[model samples]
Target: MSAHDQLLVVIDPVARRIDGESVRIAKDVLCAGAAAKICLPDGPEEFSRALTRRGGRRPVVVGDDHALLRAVAALYRGRELGDEPLSLVPVGSVASVELARSLGVPTGAVAAARTVLDGVARPLDLLADDSDGVVLGDLCIPAEAAAAASVLHPASVWDTCRSLVRTLVRPAPPAPAPRAHRLRVEADGVLLSDLDDPVEDVRVRAGDGAAEVTVTHPRHTGAEPLRTLAKVVTVSGPGFRYRADTLDVGPVRHRTWTLRPKGWALTLPPAGPPE
Candidate 1:
């Protein structure tokens, strides 16, 4: 089979444990449509090995956002990300596959698998940090927002009742007001904010060919978020944590990210007609 017709489907362990049926369905669809080599990796080492030995076959991940991130990071570390377009069959909780949904990958098993076989490879932008870290989505300083957003739903009625009872028994304390960080923010080479002005939060989004930055101040509740766009962004402050994609990273004092225009590619279902 030609390279375009060959696929290396890497089924993540978490996906297998979470949804075996969807995994089976996705595998069936992909294998029926193309020459697919299934790789059920036992761990990270094996997972990286499968991608490394994929030869010319396109890589398809049957897992959640974390799995997709892993696949991309692997290719990126090997310096093959720009050339190897990835396809994903999102299989996990709704929250876990959010990144896949955001990227226009189909969430359903059959649809996503079929997409792997029939979709077009679209180039997408990404943020590369000074430490060689990659951000497939936006990054936020102070990971609290991301952490609070990822709370999983109660699995059972009893679990729900327990949560309700706990809430009533010891009503949660009020959330602390937003605090300001003394971070120095710079876009491209222009300074947007500095340590002198305490800022509430800073967010950087990887966009078309530039990073969209927003800085807000805690003191001005009604004030608009300070926004700008640039090819590069730098944030330096007293050690602080940040959320990149779905992962929490750093208590570092400083960091920089450069926007790489159309730096990576992913196979996605074709866009439908505009309404």
Candidate 2:
């Protein structure tokens, strides 16, 4: 295969040093064989447009976890407009290590590029907020250190350190007792939990409903509390604050959020024929 048969690529400039290098190497490898056009985006907006306009062209990303998140954002922004599959070449430090490993991307740049060029297209699930902010992965809301989190990225080293400290060593003060809110929370019209009483370390999540919803409370001694997957979660506060994935938005008086699955066609290393 040659670069001409491959998809276009967009590399993030700020995606850690190693990621940039890996992207360069991946570009060379992808282009050498497929004749793919590589377009290094100056910013997120341009990348979104390129992805939207070039639906026939597979778009590959070269960056850290955030780079992939940016691409996901663009995909959601153009969800109704296009359905081109996405490819990624992970090039970051520890942050991208998990995503790369999970996706079966090789550690070596050339190997990862080969995977991208040889991968398959599959639909991936995503979570979306009311404001259209999408969470590609997990979302955590801490009760103890909410203040510190406001200052830094949710996944940042500082936040991680603080989380560890609060969880392991010196625990921070719990969030002020939950106040009475005039909102109702229901899942499939079934009452799961209500906030009339002051609650601490509350969590709500959506899942396959095969089992129970996982909830982790602050300063809990051993077991993390669990709840069932509800169709809806309604939150009402004077000003409610919630973290969706990596982005934060809200403080609205009353808002209802539901867990809905979104499909995204993604390009991965082509799968082998079934035995």
Q: Predicted candidate 1: what Cα RMSD to the true structure?
A: 7.8
lDDT of candidates 1 onward, in order: 0.87, 0.59
Model 2: residues with Cα > 4 Å off, grouped in runs:
1-4, 16-19, 80-82, 103-107, 146-185, 202-212, 216-224, 231-234, 250-257, 260-262, 270-275
Give the TM-score comparing model 1 with the true structure, all chains together: 0.86
Tens-digit lDDT track for model 1 on 15-59? 999899999999899889999999999988898789888999999
Best by TM-score: 1
Q: What is the lDDT of residue 18 in candidate 2?
A: 48
lDDT by residue (73-105, candidate 2, tens digit) is 777776641356677777777645555455455
Instruction: Please report how far candidate 1 places residue 265 from its true position, in Å.
Output: 0.7
